[model samples]
Target: MTDEISHPITMDKRVDLALAGAVVATGLLAIWMAHDFRIGKFPDPLTSRGVPYIAGGALVAGGALLAFRRLSGWRDLPGHLTVSEGTEDEAGHPASSLRAFAIMACAFVWAALLVPAGYLIATPLCLCGMMWAMRVRAPLRLIGFPVGFTLITWVIFAQMLNVLLPLGPLAPLARRLGLMY
Candidate 1:
């Protein structure tokens, strides 16, 4: 009875291992690429090579950790799988592959529109579309979350990272509004 009650949820270990392997491979590639990064007389610490090295290292470390956790926890793994994590699927309707595909389609649309439609418009639409596909019923979250997330992303990318994302038509408006800083 206790054995049945304490059975741990599990996914295939090979999947995680493969993902981790890919991450490690990517990290190795990053390190290799960083070796040839040309340095000038003066360059910011993260501008030349630090960002890629940090990102690739983090990915490799995180993937390794996930792979290790998944592999170690495989003994009590389920014979079959449905949801990947937690008991979210136990509430009657389980996770759907169709929904995942729809969300991926939304991402592709957002990427497609990013250059032409501008960040403010394309990001919010993508978020809303994904939320709709995921069946979010709350109106506030459906509306507010995307705007908030997009603004946060914009601040980080534009102000902190100094990335010049294409503003498209909003370029003039933002310029007039003194928002391009």
Candidate 2:
């Protein structure tokens, strides 16, 4: 018998293809929806629809590339896929699908609470939850990373981009602290 192992069609391939298709479809939908945006009265280098168009196009290109790679049997790809690598966790134990589900659930909760709880409150909680799900037990990292990240993003969007993020009950305090105008 030959020492070389055979790689057959597998469920993982199907799942990857399906995800790629979904990304492409989502991109197409974004492009379609962006076309319907109302024209602004003010003249600007980048219009309201520009970002969506760019983002959608990037998604389409990336998804198409991934699909092509998958269809072409990952030719010239650097690494070889092994069953042990895909199935095991960092500790060499069987990976738990529950972690993935928890992360997804956290994201959904974050989205749901974003408007009501505001970015500062909702985002940190979501980040902490995801970190916990990922088995990060350090107290400093769990608190510091999320808070720092949220503040940085808040400044970027609110101050630099001049985009308004819902402050919810923090509006008064933020105004007092000059965090928002």
Number of the predicted model whose TM-score against the real structure is largest: 2
lDDT, candidate 2, at 47 = 92
Over 75-143, each residue of candidate 2 has an lDDT whose tens digit, in order, gives 433344312213324775556799999999999999999999998899999999999998999999999
- For 20-39, candidate 1 gives per-residue lDDT tens digits of 88887888788779878887
RMSD of 2: 5.6
For candidate 2, which ten residues in a row score worst on lDDT?
Answer: 80-89
The parts of candidate 1 lying over 4 Å away from their true place are: 1-16, 33-43, 61-88, 148-165, 176-181
- lDDT score at residue 25, model 2, on the 0-100 scale: 90
Candidate 2: the clashing residue pairs are none
Residue 88 shift from truth in candidate 2, angstroms: 6.7
Span of ten consecutive residues with least summed lDDT in model 1: 1-10
Candidate 1 accuracy as lDDT: 0.82
